[model samples]
Target: MLQRPPAEPGMREDEVDTPALILDLDAFEVNLDAMAARLAPTGAKLRAHAKTHKSPVIAGLQRRRGAVGQCVQKVGEAEILAWGGVDDILVSNEVVSPLKLRRLAALNALARVQVCCDAPEAVPLLEEAAAAAGHRLGVLVEIDVGAGRCGVAPGPEAVALAERIAASPHLRFGGLQAYHGGAQHRRRPEERRAAIGGAAEAVRRTLEQLRQRGLDCPIVGGAGTGTFELELETGLWTEIQAGSYVFMDADYGRNEEAPGFRQSLFVLSQVMSAPRGTGRAVLDAGHKALPTDSGLPLVWGRPGLRYVGATDEHGALAVEDAAVPALGEKMRLVPGHCDPTVDRYDWYVGVRGGRVECLWPVAARGAMA
Candidate 1:
């Protein structure tokens, strides 16, 4: 069930409800414009991943600033974006279930839908679903460019998969899905560069083989916020699937030379407990409100405050300063993982100049199917 808007328009930031998802509108718009300016020099286009923001409002904002489309990890996310009036969407991951494939095919009537596949056996099932739905769905061959997760080997094996996709009458051979998700968080710049270099080499070799078979790739999609600049320099990745650049997290901020973007998302938690002798402050947000997958959330702009631990509904903060956060005082927490943290809330309270400016729904929050 959706919750009521935590803050109404024109309300002060401190007046908003606790454990609310907050968006710094000024910083967010700056990030958006910064991303567009950064990508304008490179020939590559932005296909901002919806798996991070999960809001069609953000999608439209990105598209209006020059994003070609949006990318999602599931068919349900694709459906949500399509229904929300996003005309172009790609399920950057594989879908093997017949019901999911049918749903993806049916979405082609509403928007341009695409999905990735790694095995030849998956082609026939996708084709059958598309044929039944009377729509030609787009398919991309996912190459294992050092991610070692969900892609086929890059050379001849990828070419074989592309060949199979092209042979299917109901499917269109879109391009390659060569995302190196693991490399996106390598703390060192040299490590990230090496990882993306190897990935680009594999993709280059695979593209050569596809060319030998008279196949042309329209899109070579891959790259996340941490490694997008490196991938852009390679000139191999045509479409950047970066999402976190819009709302950075503590994990991405840990990179040696972090992506050029400010932190725009935060969990506005209020101090519910202030134990003077123990030097501890308890917040209303914890594991349930903010995800700790990447690391503990950071106390934004609070130098002496440290988020030490968390429970289901409470987060314990260690106070190193003499001035402890009083009860009813709001604190901004930069989440460790922005993606899952965004999934916990249904509405985003857009704040500008310390006042609520608007509210946007997290339309695809739990669209994990």
Candidate 2:
């Protein structure tokens, strides 16, 4: 169980506890709206990925903002979201183990659940689990769209797998999962566009083959904050599974055509040391508080200050300006990757009008099955 911080009464953003996972409510709502608006024009349904935020609180908010449902990477994540009142969820990855598949099958009693499969072998396991639970499972066939990870080849091979899934009495063919993870962070606009174009082509060909084989994909899904527009324009993907729009990160900022949104998520770190004339300041947040896979976290509002390094519990910031942040002064640091960074925290300190309004727990945090 997780302990939630009390709601801040008449909360001012500055009054929130330091080292908390702070969320700018205004920015967050704008992000949710922007994502909805963008997808609205394209007619692409949004099934925002829960693996990024990990909080069912955030998931519910997205659903309220026009997202059709939520997609989680693991069954544990799916279970948490379902319990949190998110009735529709898609496990956008493969479930290989019998134990995990059994758990997924059991979820059908309470929610609309879907899972993905990359090979024919997974179909039988899923079928057995669904039969044991006396439920039918929704299964999507993931095709490799140049990410070169966790997908079967496009065309005949993909068709064969889908046919096998459709043939299963306990399994229903959901659709195709063609996500180009590598295209999400291409810094150059042309590069990102080209990457998704290739992925879309692969998806189109696979869909054509599936059609020939009398397999109609119902919910072709996969996209991220980086290149969702390209996928939308292709008309190949029916559902867009983007999770980072609610809390944009530094890495997403690096994208050439970054989805329009402010970075609502941040690590509220307190300055622990400030050495005069050393042009350096140290904060309490490091690897433990934020993820650095996409690179170092950016110092929010401090243009002259750069986050130079991070240890387990400390982040080094180089200050080029004369004014120094005093000890105990709080600084907001934008993480490089929002998903993994969110996994590190236990609570989201909702800030409104400069004070903490509510504390939303990271309910599905560390749900790595």
Clashes of each: 0, 5
What is the C-alpha lDDT profile of model 2 across 5-66, one tens digit per residue? 63465666666666778899999999998888888877689999999999889988888878
lDDT of 1 by residue, 1-369 (tens): 778889899999999999999999999999999999999989999999999999889999999999999999998999999999999999999999999998888888779989999988899999999999987888999999998999999999999889888988998899999999999999999999999999999999999999999999999999999999989999999999999999999999999998889999999999999986788899999999988889999999888998999899999999886478898889899999999999999999999999999999999989999
User: Whose TM-score is greatest here?
Assistant: 1
The C-alpha local distance difference test score for the whole of candidate 1 amounts to 0.94
Give the poorly placed runs of model 2, Cα more than 4 Å off.
Answer: 1-7
Instruction: Give the deviation of candidate 1 from the true structure as CA RMSD.
Output: 0.8
| Per-model CA lDDT versus the true structure | 0.94, 0.88
As for candidate 2, its clashing pairs are 11-355, 12-354, 12-355, 13-354, 13-355
User: Per-candidate TM vs. native?
Assistant: 0.99, 0.97
What pairs collide in candidate 1? none
